[model samples]
Target: MKDVYLFSGFLGSGKTSMLTDVIRQLKEKNLKPAVIMNELGKLPFDSQAVEKDIPLKEMLEGCICCSGAEKTEAQIQSLLLDSDFDVLIIETTGAAHPVEALDAVYSPLFADKLNVKGIVTVADSKLWLHRETLTPQVRSLFMEQIRHAHLLLANKTDLLTEVEQGQVVYELQGLNPHAFILQTTNGRVPLHLLEGLKATTQADKADIVKAPIASLQLGSRLVEFTDVEFSQEQFEDWVRTLPETIYRMKGYVPIEGIKNPMLFQYAYGMVQWLPEYIKMPAKLVIIGENVGSLPVIGMN
Candidate 1:
């Protein structure tokens, strides 16, 4: 059976970064894993930043709830039938509903073969209080994400002080008392967070999980590291010539003597690049505002 790790979070809450870290750790331990990612538009960004050893299936053109349900199911089911991997990590769209994504995973023909070890909800601790009224659509989406989470990760803890972070966790815990509250800065977290958890599908209404309407956010600090080889000359040149609104940039670079390319990521001002110890070289993903270039990979 495949142990599935379902990841959900609001925009910029660091779900993508967290997923990449988790995969990196798995690869470091020599474990095989599969990944499925969803995005609202036609492109997939997170799917590109990760190491290439993992098989990635992208469900695009819709959020997980409506537009891409059946296709998502088919892709996951096929991954199960074909791959003998250690785990399945799924990153849902920033605007997605985690329960809906979980529902799709547990749909009729697939549940017996899969086990849901954990539900991770990454939230921006700083934004949860001040930006409570951001948007109705986003508000609803995040509510669903937090409500279904078994591990409420209050991400971006560095944005707040030690006490403020605790307060935030307290508030969130009150909302989802059953969930284990974990405070984080950028999504760097312990691997045990995903181990040995039990989940009953929504179809099993009596065992369903839901948090209160109250607000809270928590998560781990983001860790960026890489050993990918490349010319600092070209990378710096690319940055110097980059557009103004390039929010995040991550991909691979072919090293001078290495057979496999290196993995790299850039967010805000920080950049990270790592060598693929277990995976291969694949597509490059860059996300930005008014950032108009398409990723090299056409998977989405």
Candidate 2:
């Protein structure tokens, strides 16, 4: 039987980074793993960051939980029938609800052949600790992701003091008492922590009550730029000035003074820039509530 792993996390919680490490470790163990990447934007960004050698299928322009349900089921069926991989990882968009994603995975087609190895949720320690500060709908979405997790990877623990880390874990335990919580820095979790985990069963699914998405007022805008370099400081200032509703934004940008083009990401009010060596057009997809009227250049 194939092992199916579903990774659920809020945006900027480092799901991709942890997934990269997980894939590398699985490769080291001679295990073939296929990945399904779900994105909310029409244009792809995270899919490009994944290693080329890995077998991948992307579900873009919608979340797997709702609009992309049919595609999610079809992709898994295709992978199951065509790929030789022994494991499948569905990396859902941060906006996804774990229960809905799992429901799609457990579609009648692959019931006997695949086992839900685990539903792993990676959470940002700081954000989760202060979830009350978030808008009601956004907070509901975030909590739903954590509600059904079998393993909670409390990532970005480096930003917390010892007492703070314990406090975070303690609070999460209150919400999910049975979940195994692991502290991680930069999502560097050990191989054993993720592999050989128990599969999520029907009873597990029944226990997780589905939350309504009516409250989530998410909107996305794709901004394209010509092959031009931006002033690094100016870009940073612009990113910082973005409204709080703009929760997540990521894409490639070329900074004027920087030696290399950079991959920029903004999540939880923090903007991060990583130098990119590749030659690609500058563009970004910004996701948030009430973001439709932002003064983004060349928006589509």
TM-score of each: 0.65, 0.66
Q: Which pairs clash inside model 2?
A: 230-256
Off by over 4 Å in 1: 201-300
lDDT of 1 by residue, 57-88 (tens): 88878877566767888988889777778889
Q: For candidate 2, lDDT tens digit of each residue in 1-300?
A: 888888899999989888888888889999988999999998778888678777899998898978787798789889877878978889999999876676556543345467666678899999988899999999998987886677889999999889999999998888877578899977777778677465432211112212222212333344556655677787887777787867666667777776655787666677788887766546565555444456663222
RMSD (CA, Å), each prediction: 19.1, 16.9
The candidate that wins on lDDT is 2
List per-prediction Cα lDDT, in the order shown. 0.65, 0.74
Error of 1 at 69 (Å): 1.0
Q: Where does candidate 2 stray beyond 4 Å? A: 201-300
Which ten contiguous residues of candidate 2 have the minimum total lDDT?
Answer: 201-210
Best by TM-score: 2
